[model samples]
Target chain A: MKMFPFVRGNKGNLVGCPVPNAGYSMTINIGCARRSLHGRYFGRGFDSHRLHQFSKGGDDSLTDKVDETISKENPTLDQIRTVKKSMSGAISDSVLKVSKLAIKDGFQVYEAIINLVKDVAMKSARIYMVFKRIEEDGNQIIFSEPSVVDIEKENFDKTVKLFIITKKSTSEIESTISNISEIESVSVEKFTAEGYQTEIPAVASILPPNSPVIKVLLVKIGDQTYAIAISNIERLISLDSQNVKTIEKIEIASVEEEIIPLLDMRDYFGNVKISNARQNAVIVEHESVKCGLVVDDFIKKDEVTVKTLGKIFKNAKEFCGGAILQDDSIALMMDIPYLVEKFSQVLKINVNIGQQHDI
Target chain B: MTFKITHEPFDVLTFKLGEKEYAIDVGITEMILGKCKIFKVPNSPDFLKGIVNLRGEIIPVFDLKSMINLEDRENSCSNVIIVKIDADKTGFLVDEVTEIMSIRSEFTTMKIVSANYIKGAIIKQNRLISFLDLQDLLVGKMSAFELGGKVG
Candidate 1:
């Protein structure tokens, strides 16, 4: 119970005072050591021994002050309590001062900078380790594969979030943000018209040898493509949609970067006439003739070449025979003659002509 | 050269179909007749006046007034003509037979309206009488007629 004299400073703070003839470090110069620690506090390691001295008031100056009082030969209990109280306050004040000075000294500013290193010295075997664990909780996402290029941050509606990438971008990282709605993580951002052209990128095919492609009609509408397959081609004579919208089409001879549907033909060209009266169109002398069991819409008058469409009805694809269009997107020519003949039969109309008509 | 010029007496049979008045060539007159009921044919041409039986002959009667784009788009019929066709000959009914007259060759006139469709005129007592070329008018043009069409 060695005690310090209760000496209140003008600021009303309890500070310890040295006993007579017991002052130490008049030769060792411990304050100069504390000055060096200001830089050490921010360095790679902390000087734990010196730090402990600061925390425990192990400074020879503080010891000399206590030793001088101990020579008083076990002072009264009241005197012991006063010394303990005053010593604790002085220690705290010194720690805060070093922390502030450590800030200006270009080292890491820390509370208990020296004391912390001494306490955790066993954990790191590093008495010079300066960083102290204030408070921490285990959290944060653990990614499986860090080599997956990078995950992206994006926004939709109003919420900002992250998006993962599986492929390289031909466009900007932000552009991939437009596709964020397609990802499963964000269902609320789902785009109604799914599977856009940006996703199903087109590959260049320069294969000259023609492969037997099971043909279906692909209709190019705006940027979207539609596929239609006709088995009983005769059943449709006319399906008219007065929904007329005029599109400004560049009348070039070739199709450059045109996106066509997987297996369908454009509705623009549908019915083809066979007979002479139908050179311009299928002219029916019998006026009342209309749709019955076969022959419906007036598909365009064009010839689709001979290529047997294989067992592709499973895809439920739509197309006529493959007739190359003015543009290379390929037109599957429709058999309006066959369709008309079949349906004309069910409608009780005769389409079988004995004479050949010249165009 | 036995050439004697004289005005031949021809009747200008006038009649009304809805509102307009018209007269056909009387020198080519076969018969001027009135309403003799008719039979309807399905899917017939718009101007097909109907088929009529006259003197045991099934004559196809056409209302020239309506057929010639005069008062068409109407349901009323008043008159018809019974012309002895070099092809099909039978007397047909018309509206009303007015009178007969004699006109000089100078009064006789003709003209073509549209290059394809025909239109002609004759002066009768200060009134202009139009004679429509039925055959040419029958060959009407629809939008399907495009350039590079096989005219043959």
Candidate 2:
């Protein structure tokens, strides 16, 4: 009635027990060993039936003594070892059949342990390889968390997500990841520093504290370059001289089914009329009033820091400020709102004069 | 207050306006630039030359010869003197910056001239150098320009 001893292998691999002299193979149930180890490690109470399985060897006296030792609420290691020693004599045999069976079981257990160790080592090595590959591609693993799950109850699948810090472009990193066959997918997201609650702020807002830069469309008027604030611009249209109609000497152009007054900037800047060159008009809006500012040509758009023209030019209402161009030349920023307002007033005055003449 | 004449050598920057040499206090001068582009402002007075970009700051430049009623001649001068007046900065187009001279207070003689902007005259090395009162010149021109700008 004495139960044979079973050694608990790491990661729930059950080491088979040796056979007794009765020509019967006995096994310590895997569930029993697992339960005992689980109880020992995880502090769970062990049930009497799950603690051990008795062998049918008919040694009642030794069985009663071992049972008496193991029946306590918690059996110590020494008591378990004593039970193992008492059962060893009956379980061991000097015959080749018994020896061969025992050796086969030992080989199976040894193979299971080796396979477990090899599995863990392979996983760690693969993780190291991936980390090295990322570093070689100019990326650093800021953090990594790996998890293993059972796929189809037959294979163990490991997935690792790595947070990488890199200066390389997103396309470059994507290409690098694509070359590695083991990578399933890649996701790129913008990263901000800790305690940064909102998304990235606008570039203008982050510039020098009090002086914010403004985006402007640079246009050529006569020989000078002028910047019109992009916020005030409605659109840019090519000036068609045939479509331009004059009412009471006030030039107007129809755009988007609406007629808007056109102010020739060449005349305003005192440049001689270029009769042969084509002109462009910038449709600008201010206080719900739209006007077309005619210019010689359209230049590029840029972000510029504006500086005020000092007291001497304080009365020059047509210019709000000036910006230093990249070429070290200055481009005056046109006062779009003021210009639109003034154009509307001129139109009103001309219309009034026409009405007076008709009356 | 007592009138005491002491020989304290104060620095003055001399520059040629026309055929004559003029001096202004060196402390008020910010910088001297050579041959930079000046952008003409529309509807401004004739004496108000234009505006110039002085290290990203827009300062208006005035023609010194035209402001003081000198005879109109071919202007080949390219020197500009940036001066700070009160809280504003302005530039003046001059023919040439001669040199920085330290003139004693006693060498300056109070004299009345046709141009009210001349505070006095300084005798240096047997040559007459007019000491310019820049505050009166710039302020007077600014008011006149402002008046004309308002009227136009």
Candidate 3:
């Protein structure tokens, strides 16, 4: 299988470097060509011979250096062997580093390519080609259809799989793919032009015409019932005082081997009487920072239309907005991310202050 | 021989807060709503009673008693007077809305008080009614109220 080298500071351009042979290893030049040229080659199936030619033309300094050493008059066999071994070692090291980088930055590169394709599709009015599956031999089998492409492959192989979205007809695409000897097979499924018009509008109309309804986990703290968007909540767990631990005056609870900082809703909201009743904690993740919000009880999850808290409450950061419940009572929607961030910062400050007091 | 005293009589909606009577211009009053559930907002000042969902619109209810530092009676306030200041609608929780009466300009006097919200005092009958400037009370004075006060 061929391995693609992803160079750092190369602006996400996939530099195709053929794996070195047993001897006479080729040195890789990390400098990549412009994005336009990369896109052009990527859109057309990658021809290994053309890629090799491109790499050779881009830089030949290292290769030329190795050539000059071998071409030296009366060069010993031992010297030649040493040079080959060193070249092989150097190429192997570069390959290992590039492979690691490729794995780490693979998702970013995929996102960038997807965004690029979206921009192109918006401008050209071309539909996306669905990536159907990848064969055991690393050949990506793509199904070309009109609109809504589903990508099934999680892991990628050496050959850069290009989903060439185009306005061209199936016959035209098939003829183009036929010219590229690298593409093993081309399957054409003819969709009528009217199908394209109908499908595109259907996709656009799928978005709700009215204000979008949000599903929220209704939670009660004190006399007030608040709604936390279900999307922000990771899970809900029952908690007792035994489960809670205080570190530097900050309450934390360990759930499933993960220690989460807890912010008591009753305490945070300044409820006069702190209840000794059984409590539940809603584990919420905001921008990857996890925090557990302690609440008195959990009501059933329901979909509600959130209305903005008027001008007077415009400065209230604790609540994002409020939604009228079925009982005609309004439940304030908790701003999860903001509260998590604010709570974390407060705990950090308190911990620091405690440390200073000890000092 | 008759003495005709010509003075512009503007309407004022009078409401009771504790033992004191407060009046705001009737023109600013949107509607007087009965006792509805006021959802307590976290990290809000004491003067901010809570938010009320009237129809579909969420309007903030301010405790007028707390704003003016009057002794707060327990669960006595049922009337929420919705007033429009500029483009914003705000609700004031008071004991009760007594009346909407036309008070002549002659009865009103510019009395100096510590509270900047009170524009003047109108002497109606034997009782003195404090004329409130709703704009001055609610707008640009949010920082004056202590934040993170207990919410019921």
TM-score of each: 0.26, 0.56, 0.55
Every candidate's DockQ is 0.00, 0.15, 0.19
Best by lDDT: 2
Which residue ranges in model 2 land beyond 4 Å of their true spot?
A: A1-210, B1-8, B111-114
C-alpha RMSD in Å of predicted model 1 compared with the true structure: 44.7
List per-model TM-scores for chain B. 0.64, 0.87, 0.85
On residues A111-193, what C-alpha lDDT tens digit does candidate 2 reach at each position? 00001123343443344445445555544432222211111112333544444445566566556654554445555543322
Model 1, B106: alpha-carbon shift in Å?
6.0
Could you give candidate 3's fraction of true interface contacts? Answer: 0.52
Model 2: native contacts recovered, as a fraction: 0.42
DockQ score for model 3, please?
Answer: 0.19
Score each candidate by Cα lDDT. Answer: 0.28, 0.57, 0.54
Best by TM-score: 2
Root mean square deviation (Cα) for candidate 2: 38.3
**Best-to-worst TM-score order:** 2, 3, 1
Q: Could you arrange the candidates by DockQ from highest to lowest?
A: 3, 2, 1
Span of 10 residues, lowest total lDDT, candidate 1 chain A:
A198-207
Whole-model alpha-carbon lDDT for candidate 3 = 0.54
Per-residue CA lDDT of candidate 3, range A55-160, in tens? 1021244455455654565443234334433332121112222222333533111100121221232211111121211111122221111111111111222122
